[model samples]
Target chain A: MKKRAQEVERALDVLLPLPEGPEKRLIEAMRYAVLGGGKRLRGFLVMEVASLFSVAPACAARVAASVEMLHAYSLVHDDLPAMDDDDLRRGQPSCHKAFDEATAILAGDALLTRAFEVLVDVDTHSDSQARCELVAALGAASGARGMVGGQMIDMLSEGQDLSGAEVTRLQALKTGRLIQYSAEAGAILGRAPSHQRHLIAAFGRDLGAAFQIADDILDTEGTAEEIGKTAGKDEAAGKATMVSIMGLEQARAHASMLAEQAANYLSSFGEKAANLVALTDFVVSRRS
Target chain B: MKKRAQEVERALDVLLPLPEGPEKRLIEAMRYAVLGGGKRLRGFLVMEVASLFSVAPACAARVAASVEMLHAYSLVHDDLPAMDDDDLRRGQPSCHKAFDEATAILAGDALLTRAFEVLVDVDTHSDSQARCELVAALGAASGARGMVGGQMIDMLSEGQDLSGAEVTRLQALKTGRLIQYSAEAGAILGRAPSHQRHLIAAFGRDLGAAFQIADDILDTEGTAEEIGKTAGKDEAAGKATMVSIMGLEQARAHASMLAEQAANYLSSFGEKAANLVALTDFVVSRRS
Candidate 1:
């Protein structure tokens, strides 16, 4: 437990608010939005995979922190009216809700920009090759081609019925790509090869698919009291989620199957990626 | 010139308009914002510096492209309502004006994220030291403590009273840091040491201050027809510009003084950084 917490504390440092200045109040707000709480799960995945490579905790921690910054930026933007229109995030006031619309927009903009800033700053990345690759992976995941793209589709298909494949594609881009990058980043630092990259990709994709399904189930079945946030958003939004298209039981079964597949993929790493192994299980086990 | 244009075009093929999916549309737009029309002077600065270090055009291009992305993103966000609220940029419809506000916002966010992504993906930057340093420099420039912070001060100070020193502080944070990073990043790629980095810093700072002071002058004296976008905004908004507070004649003199100081700093580069040397005069001389 102590070890787990020490790792978490290190991760938190990456999440800590940036130095203060009189001019950038909105940036200050953005830092506040990121610094506020949630699972910090994405950072954990980065660190966990790095540990598997025996790459030292600090190196992984930097990448992990970088990923967290990306995630926070997405959340801040997602909560805006053009996207989810969410008034709250992480059980607290959303960035836009807490700040004005323009401030929120600028804050989110700055946060996304700052995420890259944090990444390029870390002493661990070495040369441009290592730094650039990590930046590419994260950028692709976050941009319209990935998470933002997924979001665009989600918005357009709000009331339309999407196929199972469509649902998976959306989830894969929106959710899975980042996860893929998280694990793959560890592999990059670990100096894993093309074949290993394939395995990690499969694991991340399956895990992301399962994770999305589980989220669908949770939103449909979990209560706000238990989940600490609103649920049933998929149905209300008329969104075509795995549960919406496949039915809740089938979605649950699919999630289970995917989680199993994810675990199996990690077998190649032996025990090096044990926590990553555990995380697959943890992803599907969440109530919220 | 032919060779340089070819290189820029080839890189654009690899980089621009990011193909056609909706998820990638914003990425494409962001790419477009940075790609067409202008002389690509900033990109030129990066590649030229890299060449001096014996780095390939390919490696240098990546760094150049990344900074351009940063510049483009800032421009897009700056054009938004809460900031400059301009309807045109680069003599065309602004990103927000051309696209919708929401899409423009996401595009800026994506580009900012992509700059780091470009840095992270550089296959050649295996030397983690250089990559890490580059990333750190970028992060500092983009974050609230740097460019965004400066912008915030610029925004808040609008229509308010301010002393000359206060204006200098704002210009340094808002403008100087990015230019400083551009020079610093190239020096870093060249594996430059402290003295060289310091020299570039001095050059960038002096040049940036002059460039902004010129902008203040343009905002007063230049027409919308001449500048390609809204002019006289500083005066209209009662912005705490160098010209508004100190008068245009004095600001012009200061700009010249700054340009001279910036040119003096170029002496340390030993004639190797000739393009950067010319670029200072170019930035200060710009009518637009």
Candidate 2:
């Protein structure tokens, strides 16, 4: 896991070079928001799943980096004063707190734009069709009907009495879709059969649900130092989360069940998906 | 011009249909930001230039609508309190004003994401390569080194001394790149020869420069109602502009000269380029 994280970090460094210009600060902030942080779980999924189909390491790495860029952009915007107002991220100050709100906003926009730019580059994939598919999938995963839409629901659901199913759907859209996309991207890049692609996508969906529950658990129980962000934020803000709807013990049990189901989907790949299967356990059980 | 604008408006309405969901407000904000208003100058360029190559009207309109979506996203973000802090856009309350800050941010993000989504769709072009090219070009024009980078420079350069050349470069990156991409997109959609594409690109570059100067002049001379946005905002914010560096008369003459140079680049197409050539004059001379 650490090795994959380091690989994506190196890829990101090359993809986002700082230039000498008046707008250099904008690039700097983008770099600041993206580099040297996070578990790189989503990136790991891309590379590992791509490896199953023997996709080129460099190509997989580029897609992984692009996913990371998109994820970073979401975090930057979500941390804004008008959004979650987060002050910390990945054990450091959030983008807006480190720079300023305007720079943070522009940096997020640029990062999102740059993510698509990277995907469509010849270096990412020689086949333009595959590249176009990646762009389309990524856009659907991150756009209004996907991640941003999930975020809007999240903001609006604050202090509202949401049912368990509603909370699950919100989490699925907010975080599950991108994680699912990261896994499915490997299949798209590798040109896997539709059946195999569906298998990986299913795994991603269950794993994403499990991961979000684990995150909520961490928010409720872990210290800020351990979680690398402000703890108890959801509870304080009265946000509708699985933990809020399902109670702590029930949420933990639900996450475990989802993780197990997620692992079961990878059985079709047999030994080729061993790492991915193991990741399901790590996702739900990790302390941070 | 009015007809092309109406065509794009219809295309946008179809592209951004309101969905019945908890996130409907998010889509509503997106529709509000994009559906009505603006000159649709960028969209018109796409359709007009595509018409020169006899591309299908439906395909041209789709591309044009995508460009308008991208343009609207930029405006939405620019009007944020942390950014330009404008309360009006296209003579209506800005996204943040009509909605709220968080919703506005997400709406801008969704619009930008949807723009790429539309480009990658098969409806935009039957050729996957062309779709990929559009994604790459639009990304390059709107990313950190382009539009967002220009916004950063604009924010940082307030009250600072800037030379004519510096201001010109800033405007080129901020607004010119996207406009240039819009014009170039028509050739891309038509699969025009490399030489023809270069010719149109040159025309776009000159025209974009002229358009910015003309816009600055309007800010100086036009009323808020006429411009559909706050008048004299550049000067009020101590922003560096061509009009600030060059005297008003010199700036007007410079815009006219650039417009003429722009029209000259289209001479290679002979009478087929008549509308585009006429557009140069309308761009520079329009009251708003």
Candidate 3:
């Protein structure tokens, strides 16, 4: 996972080389948001899944970078005062704090736009059909019915008591869509059969749910230094989360069950799915 | 132009069909922002140039709508409190004012994402290569090197004196890139030769500059009622504009020269370029 994250970091540098000019600040902000930190879990997922299909590392690298860029944009926006309002991210000042709000917003916008550009480039995929499919799929994952929609639901549901199912649906929309896309990108790139793709997608969905539950658990139990962000924000904000709805113990059990179910979907890949299965365990068991 | 605008409007509706459930608010905000008002000059440029290539209206319409959505997203973000901070847009409350800040942000994000999706959809183009080209061009026009960069320059340069050359470069980045892409979309769709695409791009460049100059002029001369947006905002904000850099008469002359130069580039198409020629004149002459 660390090796894949490093590969993605290098690919991102090559893809977004610094330019000389006044507009260079925009690129700087973009680089800061993307290159600074994070587990690069989404990028890792893209590479791991692509490895299953024996896709070239170069091809998978760009796809992974694209997902990382998209994830970075979401975090930048989510950290804005209008959204989650976090001042710290990955133990550093968030994008809005490092720069001004306007610059941060434009940086996020550029990153998102650049992600699609990266996916559609000839270096990413030789076939136009594959490129278009990737673009369309990423759009569905990031747009109204995906990440943004989930964000809207999350903000709206704040302060209002939400049932366990409602919280699950909220998390599904907010984070699940992009997580699923990250895992499914490999199959799209590899031209996997429908059944195999379905299995991979299901693995992603279960893994994503487990991942969010684990995150909620961390919010309640971890320290700010360990989490690299303010701890207990969800509870302080009275935001609906799996832990809040299911209770901490139940949420942990549910997450473990989901991790197992996520691994079960990978049985088709047999022993080759070891990395993904390990990833599922890592997601649920991470301390931060 | 009015006829083309209406066609673009209908295409937007078709491209972004209404959805039921929680995400409907997002769709509504998108529709309200895109459908409520605008001259649809970008869409008109797309269809008019595509007409020269004999590309089907159906194909051209989707491209036009995509540009419109992109433009609408810029407007929505530009109007946010942290940016331009305008409450009014096209005689209506801006998205944030109408739908709240979080929803407005999501709607803008969705619109931007949807633009790429619209371009790549099979219905937009039977040729995957054409769709890929369209996606790439739009991405280039909208990303850090283009519109967003221009916006960043605009904000940073606020209240600071700038030379005419600096202002031109700023506007070119802020708005010229997408305007250029709108014209280039036709050539990509029609599979025009390289030199022809360059000609169309140059025409878009000149026309976009002239259109911006005319807009600046209207900002000085027109009322809010006439313009459908706040009048005199440029002066009030103390922002540098074409009028601010060049004296008013010189600015007008520059715009007129650009309009003529823009028309000259379309001469390769002769009579087929008639609408484009007329558009250059309209761009400089329109009150709104």
Candidate 4:
């Protein structure tokens, strides 16, 4: 919707078709899955962080591309019949709905595998160690203890009462981990020290928590038309969402608190963190 | 299994569990998918190549473990009902049959993502440039243009007439790419030069093709009991295979010929390649 968002969108348009051959059709399907409009929040975070340090525009674009692929993968599987079972994503038929279920499965697999391919073969990033760190961060966040684990917990807790802390832990793993990696991955490539890494990761954690809480609030407070996909699906599934456990008012306040915490982390970076600052606000108040 | 195979197997034995925790179940499932029995060819390739250049044992084995994880993910997805529809794999019910379809899908996803994590986290390898090369090779082989593209072609070509060249191209991408990767990946980690790298890859190409030809022969010639899975399901599915395109006798001759080509590549390495030599013969003759 915004200019930077437009830039990320255009960048993806060109990068997604880089591979050729029998992969041509499948890669087309995968690129469509990614370019199928979203907030592009994760890609924004990567580009914003890179812009802060004046890192080369081209290298930053590569990181933005990598994170988007990871995000696309999460969405595809999350909407699968066995997982969240939604029929729509980003205002159109979901991947599994648009494509066959098996194709959707393979599409997600292809995207996830291809993300690392972008990093390893990156002609622009000559620093292999930095590239390796980015790969590790991305992998850890998406692996067993990250998004997939969070999904499993989400599934298991559907009919059970989970404690507030349990819900946060699960949400952090499922949503926060990748968000954390988004920022950390950018910083790793930029050669941030240990403390700077922690600082950025802290920002991602708070931003992700606020993002999820805002989602919970929107699920209860927003209309289905406004949200694009199914709203209140969490309640229908008996999910232990913030809105369900703590009520709408508390969830809204909690998310606001997390948003402010996210902004606080960027204070160390000064005016250069303008995009990051706007991002925290976007995380808290966006409808979709 | 021999001693080193047992060593890698033992690491896998302990690596598969996560105890009782938020991420435990998903992690356990991923471990179970890999820990199941199969020929240790991929792992052996990593270790043997690492051994050739005297890389540390853990460095070599870590890459081996990641290769096994990727290999296992392929097996899991290939056995799904929409794919090959095979009921058994490696003498056990397929992951989908043993676990639910959803778990099998996620297990494959987790394993694929975790392979890159293992690559980055392990500290035994010394060459930053070479490590990146290793990562590139693995990603190329595992992603759409290599394994997944080949898989898509494999799926699309079902019930179609195929020529010998088409079958070779399919098999080269689907099977040979990763096997070629297994050898080159290890040699890269050991800091082998471009020429040396080319040699190992050449060896892998010949050996992997030989192995696949033997597999075609097995489909026509071996019993299910000996192969540990369904035999000749390819022809029943009306998918053109090497044995179908060329007669079984010709297929057997092709396999033996490929094995000789594989052996020829290894003569450059002198006697240090004994295990690789033995492995070539082993691959051609393997019943299971």
Using lDDT, rank the candidates from best to worst: 2, 3, 4, 1
Who wins the DockQ comparison?
A: 2
What DockQ, on C-alphas, does every prediction get?
0.51, 0.94, 0.86, 0.71
Ten contiguous residues minimizing lDDT sum, candidate 4 chain A: A15-24
lDDT of residue A51 for candidate 1: 70
Candidate 4 chain B — worst ten consecutive residues by lDDT sum? Answer: B122-131
- Order of candidates by DockQ, top first? 2, 3, 4, 1
Clashing pairs in 4: none
Q: On a 0 to 1 DockQ scale, where is model 2?
A: 0.94
Looking at model 2, how many pairs of residues clash?
0
Instruction: Give the per-residue lDDT digits (tens) of candidate 3, residues B192-283.
Output: 99999999999999999998899999999899989888899999998999998887899999999999999999887998888899999999
Off by over 4 Å in 2: A122-125, B122-125
Interface RMSD of each: 2.6, 0.5, 0.7, 1.5
A6-125 in candidate 1: lDDT tens per residue?
A: 565566455555555564467567766776766766777677766766777776777776677677778877787766888867777888778766677767766676667666555553
Q: TM-score of A-chain in each prediction?
A: 0.92, 0.98, 0.98, 0.95
lDDT of 3 at B275: 85
DockQ of 1: 0.51
- RMSD (Å) of each candidate, 1 decimal: 3.1, 1.0, 1.4, 1.8
What digit string (tens of lDDT, one per residue) describes model 2 on residues B1-288?
999999999999999888998989999999999985888999999999999899998999999999999999999999999999999888999999999999999999999999999998846445888998999999999999899999999999999999988999999999999999999999999899999999999999999999999999999999999999999999999988888888899999999999999999998899988989999999998998
lDDT of 1 at A5: 38
Segments of candidate 4 deviating more than 4 angstroms: A18-22, A123-125
